[model samples]
Target: MLSTTNPFTLKNIADYQYFSKEKIETAIQKSSDAFEKWSEISVSERLNFIKSLINTLTKNKQLLAETAVAEMGKPLKQALAELHKCKLLCEFYLQNSDFFLTGRKINTDGCESYTKYEPLGVVLGIMPWNFPYWQVFRFVIPTIIAGNTVLLKHSSNVAGCSILLEKLFTEAGFPENVYQNLLIPGSDVKKVIENKTVKAISLTGSEKAGASAASAAANQIKKAVLELGGSNALIVLNDADLEKTIPEAVIARFQNTGQSCIAAKRFLVQRGVYDTFMEGFTAQVAALKSGDPMNENTYIGPMARVDLAEEVEKQVNDSVAMGAKIVLGGKRNNAFYEPTILTNVTPDMPVFSQEVFGPAVPVIPFDTFEEAVALSNQSDFGLGVSIFTSDIEAIKEKVHRFQEGAVFINALVKSDPALPFGGIKRSGYGRELSMEGIHEFVNVKTVYIK
Candidate 1:
């Protein structure tokens, strides 16, 4: 059995019967069978089903939001926002998928030559607990519209949300076997990946999990898209408007209780503005209220699980021991961890070097832009980075120096349906959302005519 314990209440909320190997096999076979038919449907027809998905999401937004809150401790408001984002994504693909998937004519020696986008078969998605609905839908929507079927093996901690997602797809009028949730443990993921019916894989989770999934997919010679961990940095220059940047930085780090992969984990501020940014940032973080995820007023919630809270605590304690000062909120209770801020943090500290995966932001002072860029690029995970400065020319010159998948200027780094999202180095590879995402599982075939 797979059971989900509410991090906020520290109580068992739901239990799902695990999928046997035979059932997993059946899902794979059915998805593979469905893909043959699904891939043949016109893009306009697929858009109709996607439209139904958007309507279903809008209709059941509250229910979906509450389920995410109970299962994974995301604030109800943020949960609802995630569902809305998913809806927007559905609409995004509906408006642009045809243009994205349209064949392009190329100049060639042949009489007529063009490149066509054709769907691969079934794709296996290994999703995580954080942003459960968004992560799954972000990958599933594009894959399906590109004419591929999907089998989800969601995190064990969010089993109820996973089951709810399967139901959502069905209610959206998606054909049978088009989107199936596999209620299986992580150990069984390899078996599903090794299944010949699955043509590709996409994962959103930890660095270790991403490495393992990539290795498994590589062994099968299957295409894989991995959106892994991030220790993203928010660089604040001396000229940056603290009034505007500080609040955005706080949200970037502490929203969703700082459980996002793209959340700003490291704050690299210029020495001249270090103290000013620290005062405002710390005060903003201190004012964040941690309470019941279902509470409408709560801005911060429990860390997703007891073990996850403990991990964040260990990182903070270890960093403090390494001469880092806890500016505010370093306490932990059960699964609830306080929104923490640390100062005098050096590169050697775990809080500076590792992905904290919680509401803990470390403020590291830097003397120069070179130092700030170096500090931001020091992490092994390079998912995204944010730079705050008024000089557009200076930003253009220094933006490429920060090695990350996405860079936000005077704003928080975020994923958008219009932009391709993914990272380089240890942050994992391939893109999600936009045209790049839909093409990830499609075969770009070159056709030559005599």
Candidate 2:
């Protein structure tokens, strides 16, 4: 049985649901009971549930987008983008699950043999707030379509958004306890993870949180996947088109108001074009419009919370004190942090090494492609890196040698339903947005007969 606890938070918001020890235990128990029947239903039926959920989401994407923006401070455009991605993921899986999850036949020595894909049973998703709605659905829809039930323990800050999702599933005719959301506290997570019935775990959070959760799951010898935050770097070669690359750097660093795990934080530019790149990039950063996220014109919003914005502010200022030069911005008022750009940033600076989870960017100069690659891979976290160069050979070499989970050539960092999303080192290990993702929480069994 799963041990549960109460939800602990600074305050409560309406439309959120909290699960008690008894409640979560009951839900898991119910899920375990339902799995007997739920797992037996044809994969087609399971997918129908997902389709219904998608249809329901499409009908109310506006309200859901607004709720997430209110709860987590994501710009409304990005929030709606998250909703659209979630819907797209659902439809993609609905059309492709059988191909990804179906049993595959193997060539045997004159005998028949095949590999079977089986559910992991009672999978728990411990997700984050930056992209609340999409994060949960990115893991949930695929797991459900694979015949696995989901138990979501979302970030406390986005509890309101999480509950709305649960209600949507309920309204979509998902049976009780199927794809359930638990608005519980941090203390409760360990208990649920330890439960013998819960077969595996997936988390998207901080390095500290991922380490703790990975340790807990490891101690029990259970399967777990972690998608921790990243300090991804973007590299520009000396041969790159400065005009084309500089503007791309602005969007790459400032996307999501610069709160994404995979957002480009460090810009490694070859010294030949470094000054020109910084001139254009810094201008773009300084001119960004920051205000209420609900305002359509606002590209920059509050940093999800005032404390987070303050921490980022401190990190940028400390970098400046450590010999980093603030080329564009380094100010904060209330929750609004002006998009910041720092040049003369060395690897030793904190902003260069740490995950600056706001509208802050640091630019470093390198002399050669080798130095640029070295700078990009020096960090302990290897989530993603973007290279802006017109040299096809250099792009190939960087893509082959860059130690990140994903490498983008002449483009910014991104996540797509078609590609596997994960990281190595402290960025955490687990694919979340592709077929590889659907397999993360499942068991591959070898069914052989003598």
Candidate 3:
């Protein structure tokens, strides 16, 4: 049985029964059947359906936001922000999907030649719990609007959010089986991936899960898009405006209580300004409010579950044992982990090398701009990096030196509906937003005529 416990109260919220193998077979068939008729519709018709879905999201925003908070422990305000972002995703596709899927004319010797985008039949999305609504919408919105049906196998902890999402689709007038939630555990994910009717897979989770899913898809000769873990760096150059850089650095590290794959895990500051940055950064982190997730004013909440909090604690303790110093918070109470900062950290420590998924970060000092870039690229993850400096033009020339998927100057790295978001190396592969994202599950067909 799949179940959820409130991260704040540590009390059971609900339980869900896993789908049997036979039921999985039925769901896939239903999705395949739905894809045929759904894919045959006009792009204009699809946009109208998406408009209805957006309206449904608007009507049920509070319910959806609260469900995420009850299941995951994100602050209520942030949860609402997640729903809002989901709405923006739907609206983005609604406005541009027709153009995105439209065939393009190519200059060729033939009388008429061009390329067309067609959806793969049934695409399965394996999503995570953090930013539950936004993650699911980012993957599903574009895929379905491109004329594909979806089956979601969400994180076990956020089962409520998953089931509710399926219902929202139906309420929005989506046809039967257009979007179904598969209530199954991680073990059964391979079974779904191996199903012949399941054409493609899009997953957002840990490295191990992405590897396993990619392997299964490989064996089946099916395509998969994986968005995995990241230990991103927030590099503060010696010439950076500390006023602007310090506040963004705090939000980059501690937002969503630091449970994001794209959250800034390492702070690489130039030696000249390292001490000054720490003073302001530490003070801001200390001033953050912690309380019940449902509380509007709570800036910090529990880590989703007790085990997750324990994992962060282990990373912190191990780093301290390896000579890292805890300059600020380093305490855990059940599922609640205090916002933590570690200094005197080397690249060898767990906090620096591994993806820390809770409210903790490590600060490392660098001697030169080249060293800061090297320190940022030292990890197995290449999801993204952010550099803060006043010399935008000089930094622009050096942006190519960092081996990351995305980079932000004078700001934190973020995912936008209009921009492509994904990573290389251990962070997994394939894009997830914008034109590239909508095309990930589509067949780019070339046609020529005499």
Q: Judged by lDDT, which candidate is best?
A: 3
Stretches of candidate 2 above 4 Å error?
A: 1-18
Q: Which pairs clash in the backbone of model 3?
A: none
lDDT of 3 by residue, 74-98 (tens): 9999999988888898888888888
- Give the per-residue lDDT of model 2 (tens digit) for 185-304: 888889888998888899999988888888889988988889998899998888888788877888888878898998998888888888888778877777878777888887887777
Q: Candidate 3, after superposition: displacement of residue 245 in Å?
A: 1.0
| CA lDDT scores, all candidates in order | 0.91, 0.83, 0.93
Higher-scoring candidate on lDDT, 2 or 3: 3
Q: Give the TM-score (vs. native) of candidate 2.
A: 0.94
lDDT of 1 by residue, 1-450 (tens): 878898988889977799888998898999999988999999899889988888888998898899899988999999999998998898899899999999999988889999999998999999999999999989999899999999999999989888889999999898999999999999999888998889999999988888898899999999999999799999899999999998999899999999999999998899999888888888887788779889899999998998999999999999899899988999999999999888888999999888999999898888988888888889899899999998968798777887999989988999999999999999999999999999999999999998
Off by over 4 Å in 1: none
